[model samples]
Target chain A: MLTIHCPCCGVTAEETEFHAHGEAHLKRFGPGSSEDEFEGYLFMRKNPKGVHFERWRHQYGCGKWFHVARCTMTLEVFGSYSAQTTEPPQEIMDIIHDRRPDTAAGPAR
Target chain B: MSDPVSALKNIFDDTGLVRVSEIGPIGMVTLRGDLSDKVLGKAAVAAGGVNLPEQGQCNTEGSQGIAWMSSDELLIMCPYADVHARLADLQEKLAGSHALAVNVSDARAVFDITGDHLREVIAKLAPVDMHPDQFNGTMFRRTRFAQVPAAFWMPDGRSARIVCFRSVAQYMFDLLKDAAMPGSEVRHYA
Candidate 1:
C-alpha cells in the first residue's frame, strides 16, 4: 500500500487514511458573472502531468482539510498543507465558516 | 482530604480527559466542509468552542474539544449534559450556509485510555506509529482498534482517548482486556 506524508498530521500514513479531493486552485467567478465565466470555473481543470497541487481529506485519520502536490501519473506526493490557509473560492469559504466550531461556552453546572 | 491525584483517580477511573462509564456520557458532532475555505476556520472557532487544533491535533479547554477526523469533517466532544443543546445551536448557525453539519451524538460512545504502555497496546491493533515524536500531542486519527471502527486523540505523549460506536464497545473492551493481559501469547500487548 502507498504511504503518504500528511502535512497537517505530520506522519506517513497508509493511503486508506485519506481521500483525494480533486484538482486544486480552482478559479473564482464574480457575482452576477456571465454563464461562460461560471462554465469556465466549473468545467476547466488542469490535469497536469507532474507536481500538481490537489485537495485531500484525512478521512480515516486526522479529519483535517489539506492540500497536496503530487505527480498525476506516478502518484508521488511532494508536499501538503492545510486547506483552511489555502486559497479557495469565497463561496466555498462561506460554507466552510458556516460549519466552524461554535465558541459560546455552554452553561457551567 | 485525599491527595488530588488520588482523588481524581478515584472519580475518574479512566485515563485522559474524556471519560466513559459503564453507561457512558458520550457526545459526538460531525463538522463537514472544505478546510480550504477560510470560513471553515471562522465557523470552527465559533461552533467548536475552540479553534480547530492543528492537523492531527486536538484542543480541549474546560469540558469541550475538537478532533480533526478528516479533511472535510471534524468530531466535537462535550459533556453529556449539554451536548444536545449545543449541537442544536451549531446546526442553527449553519442553517443557510453552503456547508452541512450533522449531529451524531447518540450514535457513538467514548472511552479514555491512559497510563503507561498505552501506546504499546495500541500498536498491536493499528498500523500507525505510536511513538511520542510521531503521534503525540499534535496528532489525532480514525482507525480500527480491535477490528472495530474507532477514533483516537493524543493530547500528550503518555495518554490517549479512544471513541467507538456503542454497539461495538463490548467487543473493543474485550480486545483491550485481552491485550492488557500479562504473560499472554501476544508478546506485543503491554
Candidate 2:
C-alpha cells in the first residue's frame, strides 16, 4: 500500500486513510470559456505512463487535500506538496525535471 | 433533570485483555481558527483554563483537556455541566476574531480502552504507528478504525481514549471487541 505524507497534518498516513482525487493543477474553464476548453477541464486527463501529478485528501488524518507527484508505471512517489496553488510549486517541478529530464524540457501538459 | 445516559453505558466489556467504557456525557466543543491568533489562545485559556494544544498534542488540566485535531482546529473536552456556559464564554471572548466554537457533546462518543494490550488492540484496527517510541502519549491522531473514521489519544502507557461519530459508536465498540479477542497475534498479556 502507499504511504503518503500529509503536508498539512505533518503525518505519514496509509493509502487507506487517504482518498485520491485524480489529476491536479487543472485550470478551470468557467462560463466564458469555449466548449472544448470546458470539456477538457472536466473530462480530459493526462494519464501519462511516466511522471504524473495527483490530488489527494488526508480523509482520515487532517481532512485536508494535498498534491502528490509520482510515476504511473512504477508507482514511485517523488514527493508531496500542498494543494493550495493552481500549479506545482517550482521546487517540485525542479525535482520532477531532475528525475526525468527528457520530459522536463518539453512543454508541461 | 434525569442524568444524561451515555450511548455505550451498558456496552462495556471486560471479557478480553482490553476493556472498553464510554468516557462520559462530557462537554465537547470543536474550535476552528487560526492557530497563530493570540486572541483565540486567550479565549481558550479564559474559557477552558488551558492553552490550545500544539499539532498532534493534547493538554490536560484536571477534568479539562484539549486535543489538537489539526493545524487550525482543536477539540475541547470538559465536564458535561460546563459545556453550554463555556461555549458562550468562548464565543464572547473571541467575538471579533475569525473563530468558532460549537458544542458536539451528542454528535460524538468517546471510548476508553484500558488494559495490558491496549496498543495491540489499536494496531489491529488503525493503520497508525502505535509504537510507544513513534507515537507517544499525549499525542492525538486522527485515523481510521478498520473502515470507520476515528481519533484517539493515550493518556498514559497502557490506555487509550478513542473518539468517533455517534452513528458509528456500536460499530467501533464491536470492532474493538473482536480485535481484543483471545489468540490474536498482537495480544500481549495472554
Backbone clashes in model 2: 0
Residue pairs that clash (backbone atoms under 3 angstroms), model 2: none
lDDT of 2 at A60: 89
State each model's CA lDDT, in order: 0.63, 0.84
Interface RMSD of every predicted model, in angstroms: 3.2, 0.9
Task: State which candidate has the highest lDDT.
Answer: 2
lDDT of 1 by residue, B93-116 (tens): 666666777767667766666656
Q: Can you write out model 2's per-residue Cα lDDT over A1-101, one digit (the tens) per residue?
A: 77788999888867899999998888889999999999998999988888888999999888999999888888778779988887788887788889888
Relative to the unseen true structure, what is the Cα RMSD of model 2? 2.0
Cα lDDT tens digits for candidate 2, B34-134:
97889998887666667767788888777788888888888888888999999999999888999989999988888989988888899889998777788
Say which docking band candidate 2 falls in.
high
Best-matching candidate per TM-score: 2
